[model samples]
Target chain A: MQYTSPIREPLVLQGKTYADVTEDICRQVEAAPNPRWLGAMFLSLLALGWGSYTLYRTWWYGIGEWGLNKTVGWAWDITNFVWWVGIGHAGTLISAILLLFRQKWRTSINRAAEAMTIFAVLCAGSFILMHMGRPWLAHWALPLPNTYGSLWVNFNSPLVWDVFAISTYLTVSIVFWYMGLIPDLATIRERAKNPIARFIYGAMSFAWNGSAKTWARYEMVALVLAGLSTPLVLSVHTIVSFDFATSVIPGWHTTIFPPYFVAGAIFSGFAMVLTLMLITRHVYKLQAYITLEHIESMNKIILLTGSIVGIAYLTEFFIAWYSGVEYESYCFINRAFGPYWWAYWSMMTCNVISPQFFWFRSMRRNIYVTFALSIVVNIGMWFERFVIIVTSLHRDYVPSSWTMFWPTYVDVGDYIFSFGFFFTCFFLFAKFLPVINIAEVKAILKSSSAPSVIEKEEKVKAGVKLTPSYNPKSE
Target chain B: MTKHEETHKFLVGIFNDEDILIGAIKKLQAAGVKLHDAYTPYPVHHLDEYLGFKRSRLSKAAFLFGATGAILAATFQSYVMGIDWPMIIGGKDFIAPPSFVPVTFEFAVLCASLGMVATFLVSNGLLPWKKAVMFDPRSTDDKFVLAINLADNKKIEEAKIVELLKANGAEEVNTKEIKKK
Candidate 1:
């Protein structure tokens, strides 16, 4: 198993000190165009206000405002929920799971992805909470001791599972995100000049002297948490899948659900990572950090997962047709050519066909091309949930039960409102926290005193004699 | 020797190798000289234990602060929403558990985060306004330092300590004497 160590070819020669880099980052943010402020105002005022209006009407008018009725008891709301939840998955995958694998490339982008994870989850949860036409008393689903009016919440319920799954995932991700920030906080602490800056940074540094011992512990703890999160992340979305798999719906009850849902989630999530990153790179002026190499790597993942999800979609169809189950076949066919047929094909073309471009190295590396593809991936994923929910529910077994689900203004409004909630949180995170983990980036560029064979050989080739050279006693 | 002992002195040596610096520190520790403090641009493994530092008690304080926060949050919730107003929905019981989960969970997390933050500040004695040493900016990048405070006594044995630090791994050794500004 002997191998040569790479010669000290000067990895990232003339590396910037973390402090300088951080200050530069802060200055860049400070000096950036007022577009962020203006963007925030515009997105919030229009989207947030509209969303609030939709929510207000939903609360006042009840479930009637949505396209849901007896036939399609669950319509666009559930579709939106599943879609957003999948979209949230990419963040955890990039941050927690990738960290566990020790993928060095993830360091550059994980911060933003993790932040997006938190915000995306918030948005997803809002859709669900609002879906509860009675948004006020949404707690009846918890195992609280309520001695009156159906107080006993069934812990066994998948709905209960959803509550635990989403909440725990969110909590762990936030903690992981914050823990990762500590060293960067220390970096910021050192640069503080104003009293307020010093106070704030010093407080957050937690007496971190950057001692070797503390660093060891920090790395160990972070690794352990990453380990915990990797499986927890996989399980969280799988459990979310259980919310559907456990249901008695003909098309939804397939054995291939957990993996299918998980794949879809990652597919959507990576798309989201790309979307947010494209905007962030331009705004932050981080050409060096968020390089094309990174986008290409991510695009590869999107392609891999996109194909996986496409296969899942196809597998479901094959299974239905193979089993000769009329109801299931009808559901599958209706999805591709039903009232929501447009949404279905859109999902297929964008998600399945679009990522096919990444099979080429050139296309994958093209940032603009990937950015466009990632957006299409998101739209397709959104339609995936729509096709799954609307098509299946619209034309169930009973002919009289067949109906169309057209979202009222309230339903559409709530959709927009959730985006408002999402963007506002994101805008704030971008402002405060280092969007890229400053400390981690520095750790990646490291050197050791002991020269490897190649470095020694290179030095020898360069006729650079070692001063006071002494042979190794054993050698 | 007495004249040198009486002088506020420091032995400074510079080495580029970490192993030599570490070996020197170990030799000094073995010889029973106290290491006051050390600094590096980035963390070095085992530096704290080598210097005989204790584990941070920040976690314990955070737990205590978090407990206090949880209690207060619960009390406030019970008093205001549980008992005082008792707003029941969907024939829900007055003491519904589900309704309290969000608030209670929020309180626990909020408390833990805030407690850790405050304890982190207070334990470190990190006041906002202080002009401490900016002695060597290199301490923040690609340089290592060992500082022995001469607050209690004149640095008589500094030569031996400096020699050992240089032998073990120290790139540079320096000292500071508190002077009236």
Candidate 2:
């Protein structure tokens, strides 16, 4: 019965009991695919098809499929890789960081966010495969003893750290997401009338009998995993940043890259979560479960991280000038006023400026505005990576070697394909799994004032004579 | 805890509320009935203390696994860089531990996480494809159920236990024979 936040807006509206929560979630999985679900699936499949064709072309040809000259080796490929990786951060942060902080609000959205993280990492992994034309040799990145002269992976290389960081991140995220789903999967198993579904969910449930010892152990494991994931999340992005920071390139080699990239990752990540959650809430008719409070809280975080990213942007410029290195100073100067000034400015406008609107409570509450800004923030973040990679690499100290990097049809198609991959996986996830954490929502039913108000509404539906005490205008 | 092979007769008292379940457990324990287990949809806070279970040893296991992962990663890295294919890069020593730290740390976390989950599953007999008896399906959904092993006390009559459960606010009472594997 302890409500931590002053905002009494119930996370679960409709005086929902434990049974109601389970029924609502299980119905989403069990019900026939609605038109909206079908429409989304169609779109995702189209993207997947496009991506498959593009991959074939890239593999059939070579790295020369992209419009890469002497300069700008990594334009869209690394940009998409970093963008997807950044988008993956929000899920782990919501699940692990919020759990450690005892923020109960995370319970509603953590399941979907964790799923997003796994999917985003997969998208990032795909880019890595595509970036290496011969993805069959992808296993060479591992430290397996090779037959050729007993050569091993260079542990000192940041790329090696990347392989470990990304693979480990994906594994832990999957395990964490699956662990949280066990109880709910058991609920689905028991309720499922369909034999095939019953069989699949039954086996997946691991025969969870809901015994007291099992619940205790479940909580312990969740806590330990959360503890492990918190530091692991920080390290994943920090290691990712090392891919740039370890480089000798003028814009890439900076100590500020780690914290800067982490903040940017989180900022963009929350935006992506909001974008997806808004659609999910609307599509699934889960307004009571998702609520404006959850959305507003996420916005506040976006504002905070966005501002941090802004400060980092400014700090990077200041340091470049302060460093007194002609190359570094020119890199910063050329970024703002050079040929790719439009990309740099677009990043500044979308990532740094747009998130400032969230300071107003009304803006955060406005769904349309939130959704629009979420897309804008993602666009800005992608451009930020593009500006850093393309601009920095395009113009070097040796002017004769400098060239413009323009992505060909294959590059554009591949980027679109990753979106197709991300959404395709997401559509499948939404179709099968309980999008919300049912058990955690049930735990909060008592403390939330939502059910009392919701119960009154239900009475109204039942044609009771009770006067509705809930007032929207009073609040 | 009974062995996996043992067969036991159980009297299950089901309640909808956690408070009622906790109160029932206390009363049953006071009456000298050895409680077998309680099943709940979620982890009811303080239920472990009420059941008189000791603290879990999961943290100790995590520490052991984590240390093992760290040692393995560091040793693997050292053997590769220091002995197998020694080469000078960035003008630093080939066996530089600092440079190997990130991957080593990642490998440690990866191993520890997977190991902890494996340990939990094995300990709880919840590994994939494992089967255990379910007294009532409602326990995984909405109900709080307290199970008492009738085989623990031969003198305890079934009707007496049912009457006790009814008196203590049990919504439903049932008896079942469970075969553990």
Candidate 3:
């Protein structure tokens, strides 16, 4: 057996064996939903309903029902769209980038983060559909052959790039997430007691046999997908930033937007992961699998990315002034001191200032503080998008066209609607799927040897049978 | 009976610990035992190398698929923009390859990923409706089961194989007759 310093912390606490890992995860799926899960689901469904109702109203009344005007054309919809897309970055970062880096700490949280990526992208995609106004004509974004004499989508438009980018990101993420779930799904299929459960889980499992050859191929496929996804995730947010940077708007016209947006994306993505994971670990009582060490490690990432984002914010300001472009300088000045100064300042406080608290060990370890700051970070990111979009567009060089934009009820409703959509999917995902990746967790058990494994080893030495007695009663 | 209709008997050795399983696989291989297959709850890092399995061809397949996707993306965009409807926007040429890049990149990734996963599934015979040869349910949960097909060779008795397994620290030994489907 591999020996290390006794003081070193294990990734999985409580000395769990391979069997216990399977049991712990399968037990979550096999057992009936507890009151807490039911409560969260109930609340999520209610919000989903409310959001759907609001969206229906928007559909009924048309785009005029929104707070949008000629001047501030893109407001909360685009902000929320960008924000959701950015939130998805953490999942890809955890699952793909960290996989390539061979970071073991990621194994505990990658499953949930990947799921969050899919759901967040779903939310982000829906906003674009709604933002298009004539959702029926949304097919125009695709490069499909048209009835009107060979008309094609604008190849030069970043918006068209977004259509391809978002769809491709969503597809590859689903495939990656589903591929990772196969072995665990097979495990669930075998453990399932109910016939219905067996059928569903079995189909989802794709009849995985856990053979050595299959495992080898599975790893190869996973590695290849991860390789594909790393560049794909970076390009996704870069394309998203292109939506703004390609525009003639002074503040939006910057070369640094791509890397800045990417960094901010990872920052907000990690923050969202922390927010969800903290609650998930608490709610599911999975402290043994998702230890404080995991939380601390994630916090360190947040601090790093958050600082990069802060520097980006400062760089944008310096460049705006350094370029000696009057309109650009004025745009930055107006953002910090003009009509929407509050939004700009909130973005700074949340994205730049709040995450710095993670520099201290106590702040990183404090769950409540981390949770609160995560929400603050998300709030800041939303405002960051808002400050970039509305503030830049709300006041233009033509002072006659300048006007302060405010969100109508529908605007607020749409934001809530997207959150409801996000949460509904998340709640369902949490309940149905193994929130933790069981197979990956099993692989790490040797290193993260829970105390129980040590005790079980002792029992085996004392002549206790190694094969766990099969319980037909449970079956 | 024809080979297709014949049922194969497998001498299965179940191991709780991975270390013991690896040792047994090495010992069995050294003893000139022709192994059928090994099943585990999770992927063992160097098990395949120890068992003398060939390296996977999935990466080569991924590269070909990715190249196809990239070519398709570039060709499709070029045809649409340059020939079909050549309306100029942003004062750029209709066949501006720079603008085609994002779509091309996305398509390449999408194709490469989906193709590789599909290849993996098909290669493993793990389609949704396919039947898996389940050696033991515990293999998916906790046990590492090493199965040797008795039908393939008649040189060794079942008892001798069982003894070999037990002596090498197998938690349990059993005979299971698996049908060739």
Candidate 4:
């Protein structure tokens, strides 16, 4: 018989049967778009239009259209790049790390989170191209055989490492996400009455039969991918950190960047997940699947990661002063008291102080508080990147050359474009795909459903007790 | 090549629950009846062991693919940077293995993930255009299905097999003929 801990909160509520799981998830995919979805899509398209126009002007007039000056060359572009890339981390962590740990709650959220990873990575990648000014020559980033005067991409460069890391991360994430979607796609294909829908889902599903032998191999593939992805996810951000840490700049150069960046990435990522999931839970009416317990578990992670980030912040300050490096010490002091002090303080307040509220269990579990804090945390994360990129570059060793950076319209528009792009992709995915893994949720139903619901079920089917004895503590 | 069609016959048993299905499999095996295959909406743990299937070797495949990627990356970087056109930048050595670690690790993971998934899909006969031989479509929905091939179990009478399925809590017993390519 299946056994779950007595004190453990149920991951799935209302004791949903396998059929009910299928029906509830599939109903959203099969139904036509609701007014809310359409309205959101329209707003996203409008932002995308404005972003596209600004992107065109920037490309046409060259990088001069951006607010970047000689003093602060890498301003909003790199900040957004780092922020979005950091947001992409939560999906793989949810799918790969949580799966390896055998967290059944991941089944409800992994699909959407992984989808977010793919889209967020896409948004992050666009910045790399946008910053290049001439995106058409993007092929030069690849280590192709020297066609231009016998010069190859420097393998030693951290920028070169980013190309490999980001591309590999995106490809593997898509393969992993699509592999998980096949079985659910087959379920949708079977239920679709329209021939067009049937053919589309059927082809996408690759005719999965769900045979015991196939499932065995499928599970094996999933496990191995998860194993590979765990290290890959960590490595991707580490390489991104290397881009800054390898530089000789006082504020940017630090040994603590890799771990600090990773912790911050997960912190921001879980916040973004909470932001999207809270809305998704409401819109799709998936409260039974994504319960408060799931939110609490994610909040606990945010609390842990946020504290780690806070500690990292203090450690950076301590090292700067303790090492007796005047440049490094001055960098830290200037960040807090300089012209960009508002941005730095905002980062500290939003990222460092805001998440501390989650220390209280009630705040962690409250939906409205969680939702507001999630957005606050993301705003803090964005400023964290801005503070790191802008504050460091705005004032360097040459005091005469140091100047404050201001954003042009293109910078703001380009940022809005990513929102438009991300939400557009997410809305389409939610409408067409099963936002939750139907099969995985079904697999956990017998073991993780609420005990009280099961007891009620047992009473309805008298003399047929799924669990031999119902423990009162399960309530 | 000309297309060829094949017809296969089987006794399909429909089960409402996975627990009852597992129990039925054990009982049917004790009756000395050879089974074809079982299908379910979700994974049924230990069902493979009850069916006496061997452990999957996809992990080994992943390891081999990963090794190939590491070797390929190390060799390619060494050949290009050390021998082909070495340029000393930032006063670093011509051959730096430490710098190669990030790309090598990333490529290894990339190769392993893509290769293993390809192996899985190919081995399982899952392709976008491939036609599926389904005993019952409900197996992909909410039902558990167990099929016993008539040709594989020639000694067992059809009537006796049907009776065994019913006695072991199968909700329905039916015959299905599947066309295979």
Candidate 5:
């Protein structure tokens, strides 16, 4: 007999049947694009068009289009890179980490979140390519043999580590996401009335028949992938932190960088997930699946990670003073009181102070409050990266070369390009695929469905009769 | 019945509820019936064991692939940095093992996940163009399907098996003929 604790809230709320789960999730994919979706897609395409022009200028005219001096060389580009990469973390964390922990709420959000992870990583990677200036010689970062001696890529360099980490992270995430999509895609395939839809979904689904043997292997694969991804996700941001931590720069050099960056990544990632999911849940009418409980659960995570980030901020200040290094101490003081003090304060207020509002139960559950804070937290996160990259570089040991970094239109436009790219990909995914995982939801339906629904289903099962019907032509 | 004759014949039982399906499988198994396989829209817990399937070896394959990746990464890095044109850029030694850890970990995870998933898809005969041998299309939606091949159950009559399926709460019992490729 299936049993669940009475105290535990149902993950799949409302009286939803197995068939209803398929119908509800598949409705969006089967239907034509709504007006709201069309409008959003149009705006995204416009931004993308503008951003593409800036990207063209950056590529054609080179990094000179970006406002970069010798001292403040890596400004908006690296900051956006780190920001988008951080946002990518929430999807894998939700899909892999939460799956290992058996958080049932992850079921409703993992599909969309994984898609977000892929898109965000692509956006992050574009920054790296753009920052390379030549873009054509991007393959030089790889360890391929060339005529310039037999020199290989330095594995010791954290930048090189980033190449492996980011690529592996992206590849593994896509594989995991696609594996999960097979069963759901098969569901869509079986339900599709249009021959085009059927053939496309059928081909994508790899003709998955949902056999017992296949399900057993599928579960095993998911479990092993989760186990592998757990550490892989942690290692990704840690390697990203190494890009700064290994440097001799005062603010950039910190042993606490790994854990701090990881926490901040999750914090920002959760905020991004909320930003997308809140809008998605509303647009697609998926309130029954992506319930308030999922939002609140995600908020609790944001609160926890935000607090850790807040502590890391304080810890950095303490270490700077305690180290008794004049350069380090001056760096912290300059960040707080120097020319770019506004950026520092914005980071502190948004990343540290704003998430504390989730301490209250009402605030966590309030849709408008959560939505507003989600946007605020992301803005705060962007500021956090900006403060780290620009402030630290703008004022270093050499007072003669001290300079303030300013973003040109190209810098701003390139950032807007990522936004356009992320949203366009997301809107298309939301249109074409099942946003929520259908098979996993149905799997949990029996145990997690409401007690009333279970009773009703049980009664129906008892009264059901044998009705053998043959339809060979249906195949 | 001949092997060719029995290969095409199957006794198909459709179930709405998983509990009834599991119960029917138990009753069918206790009567010494040779069950072919069962299908469900979602994975039913312990159904593999009830159907007499061994635990999957995919985890072992993952470990093997992961180890291969780690060894390959370490060897390649060491061969390149230590032996192949070693140039000391920083003050660090020519062979730094600690620096190799990040790449090694990433490569291992990449190999393990990709390799395991590839193994799973290949083993399950899942491909983009492969025609799915579905006993009931509803098996991918809401139905629980229990399929028994007649070749493996020659001792039991087909009508008796159908009756047993009906008695055990199968919502629908039907005969399925598998067309030869």
Candidate 6:
């Protein structure tokens, strides 16, 4: 019988002092010019100017300058809104949900994922604010009391709920991410040579001292906040789901929305994470920290979430027919075979069929394939939102109100700017923050590096004791 | 005081599984031995209750911090947008609840998070303390340890400790005695 010792090292990578790890990351960042710096800059510039021009046109004219009319009151604008919201989900899920599950791989990827959630949500808000015919008058949607010109805001409106949800999610995320960064910040603070770098990291570190007691309490607090973040993350998407689920549109209102929307969010979110991570791994050359195993794990999540979203599509179709409502049935049928049939099929192919490749180990492990699939998944999710909003709203109750709505140049430009916003923030975050948690990684290393004296002594003692006890048995 | 005057013994029984550790703690509790501390690399569920820990008041911290945020945000928004400036747009009232909720919730969460972090840092005395010389670095890696100081209880003797640890399925026994120079 094997007698197992109680004391052992579970963390695989340990003993990497803050200096070693930070140097490694800095060295990587410094040595590489991001390979595509010029390209990224050029594209970003092109998109920025074009996106600015698009907005300038929209502001100069009106929201009416685009293709939206009465029946199809929402078009690419709301579609982008939902798309960005869905994209935001993957980050929080990686950081919070994976943390709860004790998935160690999450440590490598969560910082970037959390950053993505914040930026994507911001991009999403841009859509809603821009969608408003009178964007400046948007403050009226808020609830202030009378006399001070404060009016009671209706809690019933999903838009009102959204003001709470997105704001809460972003703030909570900032705290969670910052807390994780504190120890790492201290690490960077210690290692930094330059005055500016030293000051920046020092302020961010907030005088973090790596004491045992501090770690105990910090871990406790982090776990508790992680617990709080879990529900908040789920709620943000569920509330976003409610925007469509609560509406009276025949196709929009459904019981499956909350879970379905959540699933779709994760699917799209993972794809974006993979896409960025793929570029980052190549750009910064962080192959060791962001390993193939980590990519495989993310791919697994993408597959699972994608499958869940796929099942939702099937369920929605079956239920639409099973419920036997003509309008609902027609909505589903029109989605599959309507004027926007190409868009609907594209969504299905990108979301459901494409992710199926991850079932193969080769595809999941391949950086290029994973990166390509992620982009496909993102595009598919965007179209899914478009189909849901445009198909239902475009062909509503009255036939005369039905019109094919298309995106104008302004619509297209904002779409490019949305990427501009996402990439710009992500690039800045990568350059500044410890993208992979340094302290947690260091803690893991410190524990794993040494085989303790206790274990060595225990082995010696066990050996001394065993000689006497096993004599009879051996004889 | 004489240095290294050997007296009583602390028998720390080691177990591979969490369930076994739990059962041992319960036995120790039942036998009325005051637990010095139990250290595990990873958190074991409900091990704290076995060791007789009170519920953490981080929740209270969260609540207080959250309330501070709510009040501060509300006051700020009310003062800035509602009373002080009073910029009216689209005939809509100022001091909007929806707008208030965002800032309030943001501030609340912010306070709670910062409060939790700051309180943790201060309470733990973590700011660049004298480096805690490691007792066993491997403890953080993957180990469950129950520390029993022999001097803590008069009832526990050296022989009895060894017997108890052996009975509780300890893999090995070793002694650590503090020396006074």
Number of the top DockQ candidate: 4
Q: What is the per-residue lDDT of model 4 for residues A1-475, given as tens digits with 9 covering 90 to 100?
A: 4578967878887767778899999999999898999999999999999999999987898788899999899998999999999999999999999999999889999999999999999999999999999999899999887656667889999999999999999999999999999999999988989999999998999989899988888999999999999999999899999999999988899999999999999999999999999999999999888988899999999999999999998999999999999999998998889888898898899889999998998888899999999999999999989988888888889999989899999999999999999999999999999999999988888788864444655676796645423243422
Candidate 5 runs further than 4 Å off: A458-475, B1-7
Which 10 consecutive positions of candidate 3 chain B have the poorest summed lDDT?
B1-10
Worst 10 residues of 2 chain A by lDDT: A466-475
Docking class of 5: medium
Q: How close is every model to the real structure, measured as TM-score?
A: 0.76, 0.96, 0.96, 0.97, 0.96, 0.72
DockQ of every model listed?
A: 0.12, 0.71, 0.77, 0.82, 0.79, 0.10
Task: Score residue A25 of candidate 2 by CA lDDT.
Answer: 83
lDDT string, candidate 5, A156-178, tens digits: 99999999999999999899899
Better-scoring candidate (DockQ), 5 or 6: 5
Error of 4 at A107 (Å): 0.8
Give per-residue lDDT, candidate 4, residue B76.
89
lDDT against the true structure, each candidate: 0.68, 0.88, 0.87, 0.91, 0.91, 0.71
Candidate 2: tens digits of C-alpha lDDT, residues A173-213: 99999999988888888888989888899899888878888
Segments of candidate 2 deviating more than 4 angstroms: A1-8, A452-475, B1-7
Number of clashes found in candidate 3:
5
Q: Which sections of candidate 1 miss by over 4 Å?
A: A1-19, A28-37, A149-151, A447-475, B1-156, B159-181
**What are the runs in model 6 whose C-alpha is more than 4 Å off?**
A1-19, A28-35, A146-149, A446-475, B1-56, B63-181
Candidate 2 vs candidate 5, DockQ winner: 5
Candidate 5 contains a number of clashing pairs equal to: 0
Candidate 1 lDDT by residue in tens digits, B1-181: 4643343333434443334456666777677776556655455556667777776655565567657865775565556455555665556666656545544544454455455654554544433443334334444444455655444225446566666666676656676453433
Q: Write the per-residue lDDT of candidate 6 for residues B1-181, one digit (tens) a residue.
A: 8765654444455554445566777776677677655554434546666676665677678779878888987887677667666766444576666545544665576677678766766665444432322223323333345656777767766677666656675545556443321
Interface RMSD for model 1 amounts to: 7.2
